[model samples]
Target: MQQLLAPIYSFLQCETPDSWIEEAKKPEQLKGLLIDHCNCELKAAQTAMFLVRKYAIDKQSGQLLLDWAKPYENFVYIKNRDIGVFLSKGSKKNELSGELVARKDFAHSDDLIQKMVRLIKEEFHHFEQVLEIMHSRGIEYQNVRAGRYAKGMMKQVRTHEPATLIDKLIVGAFIEARSCERFAKLAPYLDDELKKFYISLLRSEARHYQDYLKLAQAISVTDIGDRVAHFAAVEAQLICSTDQDFKFHSGAPVLNVTA
Candidate 1:
């Protein structure tokens, strides 16, 4: 467990609990955690689509990606009763094939498509896993409005090509890295099933951060390390500061009068 968690701990600037195993096995705290995670998976798919549209593909493919995300997004962001049952199927049931249509003027485009597609597939799978866990406990899924976390980071993206692209990718890296870090941190505080679930995500989430970094490097002609650091500061502020909403990526909870 220590070896599996080393990267997550290092990234988050924290240590894993020696007692996490016991906390995770608890039956309480299961529903809220899994539901939040299900919402997170859908959001991950949306983030990947944003990348594909803004940087990778032409307009038509971009729209297609958006359309693919629509149903899942509706499941999470809009009211839908079957969401829990729909997602409760299984993530380990099938392998996703990576074949994509060829394109014109497609230098570096296919790579982005491949990466985004794979990410979407994984996010969907994770969404299903979370749903399945919820079903096992008879918890219904509900749509929760997103907090300001990701938008706060995205607002820092530059408004120009390549620069905009680079910043977005760097932002993507931070989001993935933070998600990996938070998963590890929250795992120990969660019940047994959720602890294992979050821990299971660590490796893939770490790799997702590295993948975003590699893509950023591949696309940028300028050194992006400084830009990455700048966004990291912004992202950290967003994560560590106070927030009124209590979604998955929200900061410290603030009471919402609407709630």
Candidate 2:
């Protein structure tokens, strides 16, 4: 376990809490947790799509982005086919070949294409792994509404050129970092299967957050540390504050009295 999560811990700015881990490990909670995680994977991919459309890709490429996300979204939201077949058919291994990565015009497109393409691949793989675990345990999947966490953070993005782009990248860093932190925190409390899975995800996710930061720096001619610090405070507030929703990335619990 230490072997798996050590790199994740070293890469992130924050640590996971014991309480969240405890809650995540409960056998009874596995189904809901996995479902929420599945949702997170799809959302992560969509977020990458938005970045590609807004910054990296041309219109036709933008359409391709939607095309890529649609099938995975279908499997998660609609569950239209067997998990194994769906995974095999829609996987991104073909799209992320070294040649494709080299052909990308990072000057015109930024690192958005290569970075997001790899991220999409990893997120989809994680989605498949979660599905396998659920299937092995006979846990039926279901759709759940998104929590307020990400939306709340994104609401803070400024409306302008490079500032907006820079802010979005900063926000992206926080989201990925927080996800890494949570995965580590939640791992120990989870059962053997999930604990292993979350730990495995940490390294890639840690790199992802770093990738966002690097892109932000590359795009801006000026120092961005101040901007990064600003968003970190904002992101910390959202994570540390009270939230009514229960999700993989939601903030402090707000009494699930209805549940």
Question: Which predicted model would earn the best TM-score?
Answer: 2
Clash count of each predicted structure: 3, 2
Regions of model 1 farther than 4 Å from truth: 1-30, 58-74, 77-80, 84-99, 254-259
Cα lDDT of model 1 by residue, 1-259, tens digit: 5676565445443222323323333455445556766887877877887777766667766666666665566666655468555555444333333334435564667878777788877887777778778778778887656669778987898998878777777777777777777687777766687779888998888888777888888888877877876776676677666666555666655434573
> Against the true structure, candidate 1 has what lDDT?
0.68
Worst 10 residues of 2 by lDDT: 94-103
Specify the poorest-scoring 10-residue window by lDDT in model 1.
13-22
Model 1 residue 54 CA deviation in Å: 4.4
lDDT per model, in order? Answer: 0.68, 0.72
Q: Looking at candidate 1, what is the lDDT of residue 254?
A: 47
Off by over 4 Å in 2: 1-19, 79-110, 255-259
On residues 143-164, what C-alpha lDDT tens digit does candidate 2 reach at each position? 7787787888788888987778
Candidate 1: which pairs clash?
Answer: 24-191, 24-192, 25-192
Candidate 1 residue 252 Cα shift, in angstroms, is 2.9
